[model samples]
Every structure is written in structure tokens, then in C-alpha cells.
Target: MSSHADHPTVIVGAGPAGLTAALCLARYRHRVIVVDSPGAPRNSASAGVHGHIGMDGVTPAEFRARAWRELSRYTTVERLEDEAEGVSSAPDGGFRVALGSGGTVQAGTVLLATGVVDVHPADVDGFAECWGRSVIHCPFCLGEENAGGSWATVADNAELAGMSAVAFRAWSEDTIAICPETMPGLETARATARSGGGDVVTGTVRRLRHREGALHGIELADGRVLERQTLVWTPRQRQQPVVQRVADELKLTVDEAGFVAVDASQSTGVPGLYAAGDLTSRWKQSVTASTAAGAAAADAIHMAALLAAVHH
Candidate 1:
């Protein structure tokens, strides 16, 4: 039901990884379609692309802009604005990708660039409202924002203090790694905290107290109020594999950690099917994802050439 039903390659996301793949494939004169999801990855739980070599400190919006500038060079590249529902396998060894609009993009191969989103803690006052503002998940993203402000690193686990406190103290001289109840590492991290001239708080944070859209402080369970303007924590992430659903010919092999098993070139268990970026279930940065996407696309082209030779 797609307007361009017979495209040779269909990309599922318009993210940096997806767009980069599309731009490369289009330069090779491969028929490509890029489906744009309604929401940008920046709008979600992702802070920024980390570990980029040249673009190490670039923000998410800056990364997206640079990618878009390159993508605009292609006139043959077809871009669709829809959320990919799932991908199905075709009898001819291709793929049929279902879109939310009840259409399907049939392609010879599929690549997924959609990344994972981090899980946040439950409703603890301004927890949700302060996202990307006063509350941050990654130290690299929000560390500079809360500089010189009283900061708190609230962890569900106590052991995170050693690492979190070490990292947090770089931006804030006054950092407290708080856990609800005392377990272990309370002393060690607390000692480490004092070494960095920081305080250790064992109070159960009832809620994040904020006013005027800026973080004010935290309300403690025992009615003790703490004066901290910024909070940081690390959370887990969840991924949706888009390519595996459509390519019935390909077999997905994931690790015990639920990451897709791939070769050096990022090829999956299937021949024509390749995945790049966060879809491989790897802990990724922009540089890694971009390098992986280029490598996978090159591998796919080589395989395609070999297949053409066999047929010829």
C-alpha cells in the first residue's frame, strides 16, 4: 500500500544513523526510502550522541542538522513520514515493512537506525518535568548546565556512588549521592564524597521540589529539605529491532544481554540483511554508530555485487 512500493532499500527511522545510511546508499544509485517518525529522537529520553570523534561535544540538534545537510544532496532518495509498525518477510527474500498508516514498503533489504530510549524513575515530584532541564540522565549532557549549583545524584542502587560521585564532582563541587536506605558503599562512597569535598545524604527523597520550571530542591521523607538545584542519574534503555521483523530470511542472533549479534562489518545472521547504529544492541556513541552504518552499507554493496555476478 505504499506509494513507492518497490524501493530496493527501505530505512525505518530518520535518525542520524538511518539518514546517514540512506545518503550513502543513494549515492550508489540504490533505490532508497527513509521513513520519518513523528517524534525526533531528541524529543525523547536521549540526551545527545556521545563519543563522537570530531563531534565529541556537539548537541543532538547539531548532529541532526549536519546529517540533514548531507541528506538533502540526494534527489532520488524517497522519505516517508510515518512510524514503522513492523517489518515482515516476503516470499522472494525481500521485506515488507508495515507503517502506521496501513501501508507497506517492500524492499530488497532493510536497515534499522532507531535507537533505544532510557527508562526514567517514577513520579518523584518534578522528575518528569525537569528532564533535559534540571534533571539529567547523562553526565556529559547536563554537567555544565548545573555548574556551581548544589547537585544530587539519586540512585536506586547505592554502589553507583563511587562512579557517579566521581563523575559528578567534576561539574559540581557540592555533590551528594543519595540512596533511600543504607546498604553498602555508603561509607566508601561517602568517604570518596568527602575526599571530593562533597556531602553524603541518606535521606529518602520524597519528591523533587521545583518552582518556575527550574529545580529548587528535594523534599525528604523525614521532612528534612535539601537545597539542590540539579539532579543526575543513570537509567536502563530498551530497544525495538525493526529489521528482524521484515526479513524472514535473516536469522537474528542476540547475546545474553539482548544485543543483536553481528560480525565485524555489522552483518547479521542473514545474508542481505544488515543493521547499523544502536539496533545492533551495542552501547553506542555517534562515532561508533556512524562508522558502523558506513561499514554495514559497504558490506551490503559488496554482497549485492557478488549476487549480481552469480546471477549474470
Candidate 2:
């Protein structure tokens, strides 16, 4: 059993990043308290986690179950199925994490693995059903599986539509860039799409034709139907409210895209505070990246504790 004062770390997420970090720290014999509520994984809507060696193609639920099972073997780790409502600095240079279930956790260090949230397009029928299956987010993760398949990019902005189309060209030459409104770079994106034997269309997606998450075509508001199979959509994303609240309290810096800014070591620029996973890097948002970040952050925390003990 570990006391609140004795716990070295409190992780505010149970996703890949936080779980991996806790596993590493457990191996190092450091007690860690991980806080996470069920049904909050950013990848819940993703069909399967791809690009992770050995664990590739594993469903998010199974991956999480495996992680929790592994963590259970370590007696030094504590798992709490609760959301961290807020984080504040404590008097002893530690952190005070307020839990949604009416309690406070004191820790010498805090790791913000609370990832971002994707803002899905509203009023789109069948979008929710086909989100993780036919509508994909990461090309590197899910592209190869659907290679040579008819593809479309349903983007709100022209840049995303064009970039997605250009990127999808490697997987499929028959790609279409679809945007709801005309914007700058659309023509360039359209040209790029055409260059790859693809096409571009501007229309609002009314409904997606799919059966049990398998996309068949995209129906437009004007009764136009694009005979496409898979859709590559990169919707707008935002930090979870808890993340923003913590960032505001700590005055943490954020990148231009509004992700929590962290260095190579996953340090939040505030001593003893760290961040990892999708919350820190958008380009490297994957199960592999998150797990690696978690491992690295664990090592850093362990080393920091060693140095502190020597100094004391």
C-alpha cells in the first residue's frame, strides 16, 4: 500500500501514454496512481490501433484491457476509474489533483496524458456509425489496409482536403477532394488531385451510404452522390476541458495548433509536470508514439527522483 505522500506520480490518463509510463515506473518499484474514467479514450471511435508493432490492428478496447492486465501484476501501481477535474500546485512543490468523484490526490509529480478531443461535423447522417470504420483519421495508420480503394477527403477547409488527397495518392490514384465551401488552396488541391487521376468536388455531405460501418458512397445535399468507399477526414480538435484548466493554472505553453507544448523529454516546462501522447504532438499521434512518450517520461521521472534523493 502506498500513501498519498509516498506516491511519486499521478497520471491523469489511462490511455497508451499514461499506462505505458505507469508500467515502466512500476518496473522501477515506484508507486504510481493513475486516474481515468471509462469511455474517454480518444481512440474509442477509431476502429483499431494500427502501426504498433506486435499490437498492430488490435482494437482499442482490447489494447486497453491488455494494458490494464499487465499493470495489475505490479503491486506498486494504483488504478482509479475517476476523472481528474482539476490540477493545482501544492504547498510542498507537489501537485494537488481534484477528482470528479469528490477527493483530492497529492503527488510529487503529475503527468498530463489527457489527450485531445476531435470535433466531429454536426448534422451529418451516418457519420457516427462509419467514423472509425470507413471514415479514417490517420493515413499512416489505416492507409495500407484500404490501399487501391476508392477514397475521398471530406474536409471543412481546402488545405486539409488537398493535403489528404495528395497523401492518399500513394495509396489510391482514384482519390477525390471534397470540401463544403470554396476556400484558398482549393484550386491547387483540386489540380493536385487531378494530377493523380483524381477529382475535386465542393458540396455538403448530407449522409454517408454505409452498411454496418462499411462506407459505400457519400450523398450530398443537392442529391449528388459520389461513389467513394473510404473517407479521409481530419476534423478540428480541441483539448479536453480538464487539460485547458490545468494549462491555465500552470500557465503551460501550447503550440500554434493549440496542443500542450512539451519538450523531447515530455516535460511541461514546469518542473515535475509532464505531458505526453496526442495532447503534446499532433503529427506523432499514434499508439506507438504515445507508448514511447510514456516510456521516456517514466525514465525521466525516475532519474529526476534519483537526483533529488542525492541532493537531499
Report the number of the highest-TM-score candidate: 2
> Residue 110 in model 2: shift from native, Å?
0.4
What TM-score fits each model?
0.79, 0.93
Candidates' lDDT values, in order? 0.68, 0.85
The residue-by-residue lDDT of candidate 2 on 147-245, one tens digit each, is: 877998876666566666567778887888887565677787777667767777998888999999989999999999998888887777999889999
For candidate 2, the 10 contiguous residues with the lowest summed lDDT are: 1-10
- CA lDDT for candidate 2: 0.85
User: Number of clashing residue pairs in every model?
Assistant: 3, 0
Per-residue error at 275 for model 1, in Å? 3.0
Off by over 4 Å in 1: 1-7, 40-66, 157-159, 241-251, 255-257, 279-282, 285-312
